[model samples]
Target: MPDRAPQPVDRQLPTDEARDLISLVRDIAQREIAPKAAEEEDAGRFPREVFTLLSESGLLGLPYDSEYGGGDQPYEVYLQVLEELAAARLTVGLGVSVHSLACHALANYGTKEQQAEHLPDMLGGGLLGAYCLSEPASGSDAASLRTKAVRGDGGSWALTGTKAWITHGGIADFCTVLARTGGEGARGITAFLVPGDAEGLSAAAPEKKMGMKGSPTAQVHFDGVRISDDRRIGEEGQGFAIALSALDSGRLGIAACAVGVAQAALDEAVAYATGREQFGRPIADFQGLRFMLADMATRIEAGRALYLTAARLRDAQRPFARQAAMAKLFCTDTAMQVTIDAVQVLGGYGYTADFPVERYMREAKVLQIVEGTNQIQRMVIARHLAGPESR
Candidate 1:
């Protein structure tokens, strides 16, 4: 049987414009992304043209300022669009998220001159971006990153360090880099906007992964990369704060992506169970399979709701860090569970590359470990509720 297209999600958009935006995204995803996702992913080919199309379609900057070539949509609206794209393909969806995170510091903290000079092209000029925070020695403990930036003559700075697990590392047009400039620990770090082709910058070979192979993840090295002082974002010693703020928002994007993956898995499971027969009847007709389907649907709904709630909090300019952590933790766990169940629903066929469920299962594992691990998310939640751990 031919593969079934995923059923449309009944999103609770706040405006007609938001609803229309979701419709446009879904149309693009089904037409442009979903069709080639499996083939290109299997070939380990990055779909650069697809991102260019997204840029031209005004989908790349949905949550930023319209004056700077953004769509001026609220986070609630922006995240639903992410969910739709992710449901079609996680590579495209997560790539967009990382690009947005790369733009966050400059958009929110850069001088007006910097915004005027850079924001338009970065937002809509078909340029890709990468966020550089995690270093070779630092992952969960991002505050301990050791990348260094030293002030030089003529009002410039020289950077030298390696950023690990960077998405779009080698292919990005630009990067938002955090480097230490003062005393030890978080307060000493500062943020800079570095062009990808900076003289001393290069990327290591992409890491071979169990899934999301089409999206390049590699270590980016900065060997005495020099930039003018104008490139520094925010005040000195503010990069850690900036990085944390961006991650609070980035976590929401991950949550939305997780829900999207789970929803896709559930759809696949439902489609397969209803068609594959056992005991001379569709497997979906059995009570056990029916209960499993119901539970899968429920989990998807709950994950969606949790992320949307966090998004709404963000839109309202309220404190959402804790909620964002909760959503990321729950939604990714939901994705992992749903995708595994999807494989079970498909039985033997699911085990083979002939079906997509096995791929989905592999892809779902990484979600639990990215942005922030589920363990880190729990720690963040605990700190918010019970205060920080005793030193």
Candidate 2:
């Protein structure tokens, strides 16, 4: 059977404008993104044009400053948009999240001159971005990254490093990169806005993955890529703090995406159950399948609430890191379980390439591992609850 279009979720949006925004997103998702998702994903084709469309539609900069070509929406509204996009396609949702992350350092910490110079183009000028912090040796221990940026004549900086698992690596129009400028740890790092086509910058072939093949993940190599000091964001020693700030919000994005995937899977399962009959009645008529569907719906609802709570706190400019970590942890784990149960609900059909649940299952696995692993999220939460772990 053909996959059904996911039903529109009833959301508690903040305003009429937010409701209209969501309606528009659902229309776009159904019309533009969902139809080609399976085919393009199977072919490992990245939807660069879709991102272009998003930029043109002002969807790319929804949570940024209106003065600099952004939509100026709050995180509460912005994350719902993410959930809708993710329900259509994880690649698009996560790509937007990463692009927003790439823009965070400059948006929050750049001088007025810097913001006026670059923010407009970055926020809405059809330019896609990548965040560069993870290195070959540093994933969870981001502060220990070893990418080097050394000062040169004429106040230029030459960056040399390999950044691993960078989404949109080769295709990005710009990258927000963190590299060492002083000593060996977090305090030595600095952020720079590097043009993707810079002289010595290059990306390796994309990684082969279990799912979301439509999204490229590659290693970015900066072989003495030179940029003027004007490209620097924040103080020389403030990059780590900036990166952490971005992650707190980025975690909320992941949580929203997780809920979206789970919602999609549950929708698929329920649709299938209602349509597919067994023993002269629909399987959904059976108590066992009904219970599973109910549980899946419940979990998805809980995940959505958790992420939204975190987003609200962030929108209010309150301390939300602990809640963000908890949201990422709970929502992603829920996605993993919901997708698994969704597959079980579909029985043998779920295991096949013919269905999207199998793909969703694979995609959900990575959410637990990315942004920060769920294990790392637990460590973060523990530190918040008690004191920092003893050395």
Candidate 3:
């Protein structure tokens, strides 16, 4: 399909200001992000300057308190912004989500002094951040993470172990890490804020992925990386809780991104069908192709609504974990199906690198696995309904 402007999404905004914010984001996305997306992803280049611009525009911390550098926008509004950015480029949108996840620990649980000291820089000081919770041996079973942090004689601690599948691993300015502070199991883990340039901290090469090549995914090693006691976030045993809380919100971000991808694919399919002719007429005139496009658009709309509902629940300060997981599961599955259908609509051209639909398909696959797999999401939802599984 030929490149075209983003299709308009009718949104329910809480205020005129929110609508204005979306317009600004769309302008930035069109002018700065969408055009270079394919080229940068092909070259496996992360657009650091784009992030700097986002920081400068106050787009990096949309959902946090404005007392810091956050935009103080609600999740409902913030997620729509994410959708706009992701429609332009997943690397940028997903990167913002991960950065918000990294800041969650300190922003929510850190002392006031810590917040005043660190939150501003993270929100808009142009510093990127990463979250470290998963180890090679403990991806889904995060409680079993083996990374250790031993208390020193004074008020410092030294961490040692490897965290896997870290987004922006090599490029982050700081990391919010979960490590063992006591005995085995979840209760022993603690969260810490460690500078990227900490002694003995290093990142291995980025993983060779099928898509999202522009965003690096790699293993980060903490070899006796030391941090002051002041860097500790929340209680010693509260790290797992903090991690789960962050993921609850992070899942909504993924859902928004999934919708963005699906929307882009649908737009491409519609554009291609309306232009590409067969049997002496545009394929869009055929009922079979028209129905496919209709279904694609319908699914995208439902997925967008589903995610927005979850985001709204979160903004209301209510119990939203079940809804968040539901959104993550439903929206990501919709993206996968919709993108695949988009490929079918384009026939042969869709399967090749010549189009972005193929890339959207590859990128959609990962959303099902991250922030708790679809299986895990079902488990979470089931637990919410039927209570925890009996041992």
Give the local distance difference test score of model 2: 0.93
Write the residue-wise lDDT of candidate 1 on 322-374 in tens digits.
99999999999999999999999999998888778887789889999989899
| Ten contiguous residues minimizing lDDT sum, candidate 3 | 1-10
**What's the residue-level lDDT of 13 in candidate 3?**
98
Q: List the residue pairs that clash in candidate 1.
A: none
lDDT of 2 by residue, 1-391 (tens): 3344557999999999999899988988988888888888889999999998999999999999999999989999999999999988888888898999899989999999999999899899999999999999999999999999999999999999999999998999999999999998889999999998999999999999998899999999999999999999999988999999999999999999999889989999998899999999999999999999999999899999999999999988999999999999999999999999999999999999898999899999999998999999999999999989888
> Measured by C-alpha RMSD in angstroms, how accurate is candidate 1?
1.0
lDDT of 2 at 37: 86
lDDT of 3: 0.92
Evaluated at residue 16, the lDDT of candidate 3 is 94
Global lDDT of each model? 0.92, 0.93, 0.92
TM-score for candidate 1: 0.99
In candidate 1, what residue range of length 10 has the lowest lDDT sum? 1-10
Per-candidate TM-scores read: 0.99, 0.99, 0.98
